[model samples]
Target: MVSTAAFLRRAFACAAFALVSAAHADLKVGIDLSSTGPAAVIGITSKNAIQMWPATIAGQKAQYIVLDDGTDPGKAVANIRKLIDEDHVDVIVGPNITPAALAALDPVAASQTPMITLIGSASVVEPQEGKRVWAFKMAQTDGAMADVMTRYMANHGVKTVAFIGFADSYGDSWLNEFKRFAELRHIRLVATERFNRNDASVTGQVLKLIAAKPDAVLVAGAGTPAALPQRTLVERGFKGPIYQTHGIATPEFIRLGGKEVEGTLFPTQPVVVARTLPADHPAKKAALAFVTAYEDKYGPGSVTQFAGDAAGVYPRLEDAVARALKKAQPGTVQFRVALREELEHAHELVVPNGVVNTSAKDHVGLDQRASVMGAIRGGKFVFISE
Candidate 1:
């Protein structure tokens, strides 16, 4: 015959075991990336960061399902559909390059799935609500990059600039933002040119840019492909200062461009220069923490801005996941919806790159504090104090 106290204890133990088992149910996270095409360099770093994600989120087991989009928009859309329809991922991240992220917008919006894009396009999450309610961006927008670049130019006495970028939306977005800022600063746009990322040579474009006789040249492309224009410019003896966007911050770009890319200036997040940042900087603590953890696993000097962006998704999802878990169980549509709502309300959250204070009106939620100017020195990125 069991005593009453002993019977009660056994019953409570069984209930606790059941609850723990239920909590262990997988929280699926889907990631789509450009792992094998023009954007591979960017995608690979992002994938590396994703692989390092914590096994648990909001105290529940997590399952991350990754897919390669091949840097194609059609394939990216297909992957997003599969992740939602088949895998039933609670949340989605990635499509690193801008074009793919733009193409994925419709599918993600239609499915009402929240997607965190790694591209540098404000159009990905504009107007805060309505069409883009389900979308968020991890990377800094082109407009933000333009702001800092223009300010640097104004202070550095660059009165005229020539522009060369990819002949796609990425380039178009940069041109639009740069033009907007340049006009306000009274900077003359000497020449504008476009080229395909896979172009064998940019001799013709470089010649035209040189003839413009601008004080500086801005290359508005990303990844390894962005090196082509600068190299051609060097070969053609264009002696003007050459500037690049944050797109070409990876080691591959530096290796490919070699000495030609030396001294190239660009704007980037604080993570790119974590160690050099002041101890009291808002993102310094978080930035160093990520760098330490990532380098400990992947070896020193392997981290990139793209990887930092990928790592950013975890904290962005953390608060949302914790709040959503109270309303609905993971793996359910209701939980995903609740998570989206919570993400929009995330405030005063610090990450490796910046202090994220997301709101319905601002998804990226970063100001000038998020970025610092950097230059390539001896094949490494060095901070350039303003």
Candidate 2:
């Protein structure tokens, strides 16, 4: 039989160890983004925003492991596996390119980890079933942006349009969404073309578009590469109005296209034109706050829509983590599940990008309020009323 004093000591030691374990619980977040290669412009800004996140969340120490996927889908899958299997991260964020995000779905679902992707396509989270149930998106969907763009085109008397987008998932989503919205607005798509993101020349595509003689042209590519088609069109003297998608809102697009993209119109989130937004806009204050914070740290004119999307992740995690803590401690499968469930309950939660109101059926909680018609005038993205 053990002595009474020895039993008391053992009980005290066990209690102390449990207390220490609870105090040291950490919330691990794994981030994989294309910090190099074709989508570097989008990924770099997102990385900047992630760097600004606090070291702690919901009273627990936070650990962030960032990996660069180099804009490659296979690399993204490897990164996701490493983060989940090796690091045992509770949540994963990023792989901002659509193909990479799509490729990462299997690993996240298999491990039951939650992912919040920054890509513009909605296919990663839509249909909200199976593997997609574990995925969520930060950027506004292509369909929503297409809706606003088509509405603007209709109001401006653009009856016919030409389409030239990348030969990738991003372009595929844009093409389908634009088709649906354009059809509803009674706008005819006269010419359709596809080009690789790294292609040096799109002269053949531009020549075809010119031959069609559409009233307007829509370039549905993203980042600096998207400038190729528009610049070629301008060089070829296709004078009709040219529209772009939300994907090309970066400063690099302007620098690359120069005079060619001067009057380009596109649908973008309020953060892209925060200063130009009206006072009554729901996202104005949040957008301005993020712009100021981001530009102050990175320098003037450094903020981008991608950075806004990444920064929004902080508030999203904050809201969900606070509630999730009630269910389980961080670093556990239960904690991850609780966080995912709480994310879907976000209601009117304002962030730098826009207000989010998630639900079981809608992982991306933004609506019309998040989108605005923007035009590049005087080398700046300015808001334009439809």
Predicted model with the maximum TM-score: 2
Report the lDDT tens digits of candidate 2 across residue range 1-386.
11112211221122111111232348888899999999999999999877766666656667878899999999999999999998888899998899999999999999989999999999999899999999988889999999999999999999999999999999999999999999999999999999998999999999999999999999999999999999999999999999999999888889989999999999999889999998998888778877776777788888899998988887777778889999998778998899999989887888777889899899999988889999999999999999
**Number of the top candidate by lDDT?**
2
Instruction: Quote the lDDT for 70 in model 2.
Output: 94
Models 1 onward score TM values of 0.92, 0.93
Candidates in order have lDDT scores of 0.82, 0.87
The local lDDT score (0 to 100) that residue 21 gets in candidate 2 is: 25
What does candidate 1's lDDT look like per residue over 1-386, in tens digits? Answer: 11112211222123112111233347888899989888999999888877666566767777778899998888998999998998788888988977788788787777778888998878878867665888898888888889898889999999999999999899999999999999988898999999987788888998999999999999999999999999999888888789999888888898899999998999888778888887677877777777776777677877889988888887788767889888988777788788888888777777778877788888787777787888888788877877
- Which regions of candidate 1 deviate over 4 angstroms? 1-25
Clashes of each: 0, 0
